[model samples]
Target: MLRVAVDRDGGVTLDDVADATREIDRVLEESDVMGELPFTLEVTSRGVDRPLTLPRHWRRNEDRLVKITLVEGGEVTGRIVASTEESATLDVDGDTREVLYADVAKALVQIEFNRKKKQNDSEDA
Candidate 1:
């Protein structure tokens, strides 16, 4: 079994996955890279559980909530406002904080099921 993770700035869509799968399949079929071995190809997007280790990962996750564990032994949860090659600016509890990528041991995107609902509710009122 093979897994392919497709990622983008906004997010990965069904079309994106389909296109990538098709292209990869075409390439493999043309090259016979598997050498007659039966295998399965699975194309997917980067999951929320995936850790943010690269500058591009942080940049692509802008406006999303994340929980970061510092190398020094502490954790911080916030929404990513902006990111650069060296660091990320996050909005934590209405305050903006900058955290260096080197200082981050691990960072994972947080899932919010009702965040949009809450925003819409506030807008309606």
Candidate 2:
């Protein structure tokens, strides 16, 4: 199976996915890269649970909660406040901490469900 991941700022649209699929199909058909190999081309969006690796990934995930595993073996949970090509600044309990991308071993977006609801309920009191 050949999986293709396409992304854009904000998000990608259906047209983008369709166009990518068509382009990929055309390339595969024209080229002998597959060498008559039977393959399934699957184009899909990047999953929220995907690990953050590139600077673009970090930038796209700004304002989202993420659990970062440091190369030194410690883990940190924070919201991505800002990101640059070399590093990202995370807001950990209102304190901003800068983490270099090279120091990050793994980073995954944390899914939040009721946190917003709880926060709003407290504000209404």
**Which residue pairs in candidate 2 collide?**
none
For candidate 1, write residues 1-125 as lDDT tens digits.
88899998877788999999999999988997788998899999987788999998998898899999999999999999999999999999999999999999999999987776545456643
Q: What is the lDDT of candidate 1?
A: 0.91
Model 1 pairs in collision? none
Which runs in model 2 stand beyond 4 Å of their true positions? 13-41, 115-125
- Worst 10 contiguous positions by lDDT, candidate 1: 116-125
Q: lDDT for model 2, please.
A: 0.88
Q: Over the stretch 5-40, how does candidate 2's per-residue lDDT look in tens digits?
A: 998655567788999999999999999998888999
Per-residue error at 25 for model 2, in Å?
Answer: 8.1
Assess candidate 2 and give its TM-score to the true structure. Answer: 0.68
Find the candidate with the highest lDDT and give its number: 1
Model 1 clash count equals 0
